[model samples]
Target chain A: MHALSLPTWWIHVASVLEWMLAMVAVIRWGERRGETEWRWLALAMLPALVSAMAACTWHLFDNPIELQGLVVFQAGTTLLGNVALAAAAWTLLPERSQS
Target chain B: MTVVGLGALAAVDPSPLFVLSLLPYLAFLRWAAASKRFPPLALRGFQFTLVFVAVTIAAAVVAELRFGQQLADVDRLHGSAEAFLTVANLLVLWGFSRAEPGQEPPDPEASTTGPSGEQVLSTGVEPAVPPEDGASVLDPE
Candidate 1:
């Protein structure tokens, strides 16, 4: 909160909101196209979303020494999210080649 | 003892994880680039996420070396890194939204009539039937 400037907070909040919107939009687009596999893409987005939240929470606490654990959690989730997203993208390829 | 162990683990540098994430992301980029059917803009967006990681790492290094502070403690550098992620995400959303079924240019002949006499385009712009009650919110019309 007070740890970050107003514009910084705006960027943080907006990125979180935008990421959620992207997940929802992707899921809806998949459903509309009758592609059940797209749900995996949405599910894969969760780790990144959690990572963003952890970053925000760490900042919200004013980056206290006690909550340094959140930073490690954030990094781990970011790694998991990247790997999951890669796998999810691969899932989209097979069906796409067919259509 | 448990608290001490947890604190020690937390104190371990998390930077290595960020660096390691690049390996999988590069693999993702290769797959996306090779796939003709993958949304082009979405592919670019994914690539830009790599840029975000790079920028964040640079910013973190500068924060520690120049200012003797963490990236999070330096608002401007942190915000700049995050801005890249925001752009990357927006591009992903835009690219996916533009993605139609089959990832082909629209053909007028691709439209077929539903049982209710409404037109359903194979492009995926229109649904064949209205979603029923209790359908998942992910069902968009």
Candidate 2:
């Protein structure tokens, strides 16, 4: 195969790191509003963390059925995380007076 | 990342199952775009998603052309695809983090009551107070 294994490994590593950074950034952005907002961000991040873990561990599975399950799980996590993020953003509306 | 690869691996080819796995993320992207809370961010996200998907497909095609239809080669392409998409996501997050959403200030002039605050809103008239003597209150007809 033209695709080398080592470069592929680096790419996966980078992907994980990028996902972590994105989660942190999302949390910090939400936290600027208040603790409640921060909590929402934290909640949103859980699925993403799970998805990342799946991505990291996917290679261990040799069974086709198991791989399919992981794929479904990944899609679910990404969807849940993104929806949570959107909801969190809506919660942190611009220019609401602080209670 | 793993999802995309495993999705492709589930099938012999990379297109059908991988696209299926990616559908949810695409749906989320569209929803976020329509949300209008962060128009620029939403736009950038759309652009990045398109790029990520396009690059992934192109890479998979190139690998198939070069190395025949092998699982390892497809997996490698999936890794690169994931890496690209992850970078795009990170960029989107960075832009989002830089944003400062201001809180809406309460409008002082907009009184809760009508122009004059003395009128009792519920009854649509001034409130009646009884005096100490056996005085008749405002007995309306």
Using TM-score, give the best candidate's number.
1
Expressed as tens digits, the lDDT of each residue in B1-56 for candidate 1 is: 75565477598788798778778778767765654435677778878888887898
Q: Could you say which candidate leads in lDDT?
A: 1
Candidate 2 residue lDDT tens string, A1-99: 234366766666776676667667656644443334555645765786787676555544432454655655665676667667556555544334233
How much is B50 displaced in model 1, in angstroms?
1.2
| Recovery fraction of native interface contacts for candidate 1 | 0.49
Task: List DockQ for all candidates.
Answer: 0.47, 0.19
Q: Which TM-score value belongs to model 1?
A: 0.78
lDDT of 1 by residue, A1-99 (tens): 687888888888888887898888778766655657778888988999999998899899899888778788888898899899788777756445456
Q: What TM value does model 2 have?
A: 0.55
Cα RMSDs, all models: 8.0, 13.5
lDDT of each: 0.75, 0.54
True contacts kept of each: 0.49, 0.26
Docking model 2 quality class: incorrect
Worst 10 residues of 2 chain B by lDDT: B109-118
Clashing pairs in 2: A95-B102, A95-B103, A95-B104, A96-B103, A96-B104
